[model samples]
Target: MLLLELVETTQTVASTRSRLAKVDALAHLLRRLDPAEIPTAVGLLSAKPRQGRVGVGWSTVAAAKEEPAAKPSLTVADLDAGLDRLLATAGTGSGAERAATLRKLMAAATAPEQSFVTGVLLGELRTGALEGVLTDAVARASGRPAGAVRRAAMLSGDLGGTAMLALTGTEAELDAVGLVVGRPVLPMLAATAASPSAAVEATGEASVEHKLDGARIQVHRAGDDVSIFTRNLADVTHRLPEVVQVVRSLPVRDVILDGETLALDEEGVPRPFQETMSRFGADAVRETVLHPWFFDVLHIDGQDLLDEPLSVRIEVLERIAPAHRIPGEVTADPAVAERVSQDALAAGHEGVVVKAVESTYAAGRRGSNWVKVKPVHTYDLVVLACEWGSGRRTGMLSNLHLGALDPTGEFGEPGGYVMVGKTFKGLTDELLRWQTERFQELEVRRTAGTVWTEPVTVVEIAIDGVQQSPRYPGGIALRFARVKRYREDKAPADADTIQTLRALLRP
Candidate 1:
């Protein structure tokens, strides 16, 4: 099929929020797509070629500039080649060369195509149609079950390979058809339960472990070489040398262990979530102090345990993993699990993740098979300021200043209040307007476009615990701090006190 056809289908899919309609459109597009073109098309769809920082910056500005309309007859190959040329020439040439190249490419395409290509390069294609949606579409077009396609695709991490297998009868013909760590595997998406009793009822028999307030890390070790990847599958090996050292020290070779990476206090309690994140950045691997806690093993000694039950894999994990592989685990009783949960909270940990004894590791699946039960509710926070939001949210609120009540702070000197690390999540048009308006009215300090708001609003914040922080005005910082609600009815004075927050420090 022509690139324009696919682009048209994308437009149709993008316009509709109805998942079923989007799926149907995608399925139709997949049916018309030449299987051989799948890889190149996917690559082109995901490409953002840049030769160097200079070229990239220039091209970004050039692409942003408005240009005169030109005839539209560009093919996908032509566009791909142009992008490759732009990236290759980005830092190597003058500003004029970069601008001319961008203008030429822009002139060759229609407005819609330019928009689509731009979105793809920026990795912000928000059509709600991801790999899963595409898998379903392919299955619908070819009359195969979605599960079969998902399983094959997950094991290979190749949509084209999975598509060929689903369309043509070649899965049986292919060799090496199981999950491998270090390679991207679609994680099993999870479902939610309202309460602990509901979780118990869903699983029947379960093993619960302390749900830590840490970064989700996947460790893939092959012999002396070890690599650590974040939940997003970005290579985080450098930022976590301590974790790398621990994994390299393991007796077992050729293994993929899944777990969390935490920054612990002197007393061994997990530190603030931001501290854990701070260990990762451009120089993260070089300087950040991090610790790993292994929870599951997908592959060990050339064995793929993804199809095996959780009970069997845990046995393998416990055998090969290092000692002190996280704490507070192993129990079938719900009451015991509850005790574990309480102890986790009492000891300044997050909560517990209850896993079904017979549950298999379902890649990219988030089912009730493994349920996370936390003592506190966490909200998605939006960074209001670097403390600047984008566009209108700019200047005043860039770094999000997170606040939670100290139900227990009054007993302490200066009578307690604490600020958590700033986050930028859950911002909507309305919330941005309210915040922007409020900040303008209550600006205490202004730097560039940013304005620090008066500490007037008390947001109900949930967190794992409090830890020492050198950044915030308050000496302490929040761990995994997130908004639970806007405490419109409660005054800041009535918000949880510093003493209440200090009560959670169980080190």
Candidate 2:
């Protein structure tokens, strides 16, 4: 299919607020794709390239300025092959090569095509058509059940591959896709609850386990060969030799385990998240050694446990990696679950995850079966600026640049707020409209993407916590920040101090 056709559909998808409309448009486009074009089409629509990061950045994209071609000429295959060329280079002096290659490709695209390519290269295709929408599209196009398509993609850990199957293969063929001991399936995610009691109340009988503030891991073992994957499915087997050795020591010859790995201090207490990230975020070795902790098993021997209940999966996990199992208790009592949360906190862990005892693993999606409860800290912060939105939120002020009161002038003028992070979450349509109107009146200046405000707006923000950061002036950043509400009752001076935020960071 022509890239322009896909680009037009993307515009339509982004223009619509109704998810059903987006799905319909995408499904129609998917039905017209040739077999060879399926993977590229799915990848582009999903806003992720199958080749992964190809070393292109904003600088590379900005330099690729050229006049648009009069008519469409690029094919999906053409762009895919060009991305492959960009991905081939690495090491020193690769940036210039990548930039040149990116320019060449951009020069060939029309104006709309260039815009689409920019989104793809930058990984910011905010079309409101991610995997969830695309999965429904595939099911619609292929006349198959959405659940079947979703399950196939989850089990294979490849939406591109799943799209191909749905378009070309039979229902039996899709159903045949099952747990492969050596392949990493997407890890099951948890929904957030207000508290442990609330989560246990929702799940009835549940397992409340410590939710480690560390990197997520999915380990796959077949015979003596072992591979470890990050949450995003990146193979980090070489970066974690210790994790590999530990997985190899498991009694089962063929198994897949879902867990976390983090560095621990001398007292066997979990280190700060930054310390854990120092060990995890780099390819090169650091001084800290990360230890793996297992919480659930997806596959054991030839038996696939994904369809089994969490209770059954935990049984297999406990039997195999008894030493690495995360601390948890099986209980129907909400008070007991609350006690478990306290224990996890006292033990230096993040918090507790309350999981339904009878729930099966729902990969690649956050279901209600598992709920994570974490202590939240809310503070009155100043809105430094706002960024223009995309997709359904186009032409509206969306992301809020949050700042904290620097009362002591340690980082800036006394009473001036220091920028920490940005968030667009937890904003309703009413809030978006209000922000767009209110921020325009408060705007002092404008940039290409952001509208700088006078920092007069006081808003209450809730955060999972704070993390040490070198980017922020106050040496801290908010984690999972969301706008609770605009605090019209409070003034800028009454906002939470920067020290208060920094204090939430671990020692």
Candidate 3:
């Protein structure tokens, strides 16, 4: 199929707010693709390339000076080949070479096609038709059950591979794609609960385990070879030799363990999330040592336990790695679950994850069988500015520039607020319209995208926690912050202090 066809399908998908419409548009596109183009087509639709990060940044894409062609001529295979060449080129003076190549590619594409390709290359394509919607399209086009396609995709950790199989291969072949020891399966995700007792109540009889504030690791061991993968299935075995050594030393061979790894202090307590991440991707010169803590076992001794219940998997995990297992207990009692959460926090951990005892592992999807509970911190912050929105929120004032009151006169002048981070989440259309009208009235100045406000609009913001930041003036930034509401009754002086937010960093 031509690249223009896929680009048009993406535009159609993004033009709709209804998910069913997106699925229908994607399914139509999928039906037209040949088996050879499945991988590239799926990758482009999902806003990822089959070759992965070609090192083409916004500067390279923006440097393309050639005028777009009036007609569409690029095919899917041709586009993929061009990206391959872009990825293969490296070292000194490759910037000019890449810019020239991108210009040639864009020159061949039409105006709309250029925009779509630029979005895909820059990883900014928010068409609302990514994995979940694309999976449904694959199922619809292939005449297979959605559940079967989803399981295959999750098990293989490859949507493109799953799409190829479901479209061309038999149902038996798709079912044969199960958990392999060397390959990484998509780690099961968790839903959020208000509290541990609420999580326990939601899951019934549960295994509440300590949720550590660390990088997630999925270790796959076969004989003497051990491989470690992150939650997104990126192989990092070489970067995590400490984890590899621990996995190699395990008593059982041929095992797949799902766990968390964090750098611990001299007292053996987990360090802050940022401290752990500082060494997670650093070179070998780093002094921090990451310790692995396993919570679930997916495979053991050549037997796959992903289909088994959590109780069965926990038994195997406890038997093999009792010393490194995350602390927890099995109970239906809400009080017991609350105590486990308290213990986790006291041990310098994040919170707790309550998992259903009878639930089998559901990969990729955030199943209700598992739920996480963590304390939240809410503060009255002042809105310093707002940025122009994009995609569905185009032309609206979105992404608020949040600021904390700096009363100590450290960051800015005596009583001026300091910018911490930006957030556009938790806003309805009504609220967006209200903000567009109100912030424009309070606008002191304007930029290309942002409108600087008078810092008079007091808003309530809830965040997971604060992290050490080098960009913000307060040396801290909010994590997962969202707007609760605009506090009309509160004044800027009555807002929370920067010290109040920084204190949340303490364990």
Candidate 4:
């Protein structure tokens, strides 16, 4: 398949707002892909390369300038070669040298091709379609059921590999082949129920676990050797030496456990999420304050418990896992679960996760087997303006200026609005680009390079709570306010009233 073919599909998908249509279009393209072309195709579709905040920018015009002596341009083979060279030079060169090499390779391609390469580098290809959509596409192309394709990919964490296997044989045959190969497959992470009623509806009986505020970790131990990794699969074995020591002491050998790593206070209460993140940088490994709490075991002693039900896995986890676990879990009663939720909040924890007893580990699927119940508070808000971002967010209006929604539905008048804060969180890069373009189209004022947008995106803000503010019209401010999602389904006229804000004011 030509790179242009994939690029056209991406452009079409990026322009479309209807997700179902996007999925259908992607599925059609996948069906037409040659089996041998799947790996390069997937690689092209998923590359997300990002430059740092500093350095020269590359626009179409910029790329056209200072053209090199039309040397033989990059091909698929060149991409592979470039990646090999990058890996070879990875830890040996200065950051600038690596960045320059990556930039040169990226510039050698056309715009769409550059987009593809960038996506691969950033580890996320936000073409508006997720794994399920891609799975459907693969199954349609390979003449297999979507469920089988999804399961195989879940087991392998490599969609291209799964697609290859599915095209050639049955899932059972693939599983047997996988066992023989003995390569580490994907770990099955816990899923969540979409709603409280969904949690009850899924399992006939529901159990609740305190949803501690921490980072998700997967620990793999073989004899005395232990490795700890974050949810994104980046190895952090050296960063948390204390946690590694704890895992090494567990009696079991050859086990994989899933849990949270937190920073705890003197009273054993968990520290803030930022504190845990602080222990992740280049110098973090030497810090000793990080603590871990093991919650589930997906594999132990060569027995893969992923196929087993949650209750069964919990039994195995309790038996072979470490004695120290996240404290205070209540089961089978919503009333008691509510009390536990209250206790968790009082103790400075996040909230509770109510899970179904019989739910199996659904790798990469947000299935309705677990439900997170966080305390929701509402804030009246106004849209100020959006800001441009760097790196993966280049040329995009990636951050928002948020203000309390004036009860009077007025701006610039007395007590009309308050500029509380700004946030770039909760937005995927694709969303950033879309918002940037939209903001430009809706620009009401312009200053320097910044454009003030029409206050059209009305949204309700949720946070842990509010804090006193020197800024903001309501004399209080939102804590950790982020775009939960665009309120496109909602009109500004329907925004939460100031009375709601008054009710939530801290005494």
Please tell me which predicted candidate would have the highest TM-score against the true structure: 3
Give the local distance difference test score of model 2.
0.84
Reference-based TM-score of each model: 0.70, 0.76, 0.77, 0.66
Per-candidate Cα lDDT values, in order, are 0.61, 0.84, 0.84, 0.61
lDDT for 403 (candidate 4): 62
How close is each model in CA RMSD to the real structure? Answer: 12.1, 12.2, 12.3, 10.9
User: Following a full C-alpha superposition, what root-mean-square deviation does model 1 have from the true structure?
Assistant: 12.1
Per-residue lDDT of candidate 1, residues 38-88 (tens digit): 544544322211211123332364355555345457666665566666666
Local accuracy of candidate 2 as per-residue lDDT tens digits, 152-259: 999998899999998999999999998887788888877667789989999899999998878898999998899988887778888898899998898888988999
Which lDDT tens digits does candidate 4 get at residues 1-507?
555567677666655665566667776776667776666565454332212112222232233333332333555546655555555553554455656667677667766666555544433244544445566777776677777787777766677677677765676765543321123445443433333444445445655667777767778887788887666556778787888888878777777787787788888877755566566544545443877776667778777877788788778777765375655453665556667778878888767667677877776654457666667653436566888777877777877887654433233221234566677777866567778877776565667656676555665556655666667656565678766555442334334444444445557
Q: Could you tell me the TM-score of candidate 3?
A: 0.77
- Candidate 4's error at 374, in angstroms? 1.4
Model 3 segments beyond 4 Å from truth? 377-507
Worst 10 residues of 2 by lDDT: 407-416
On TM-score, who's better, 2 or 4?
A: 2
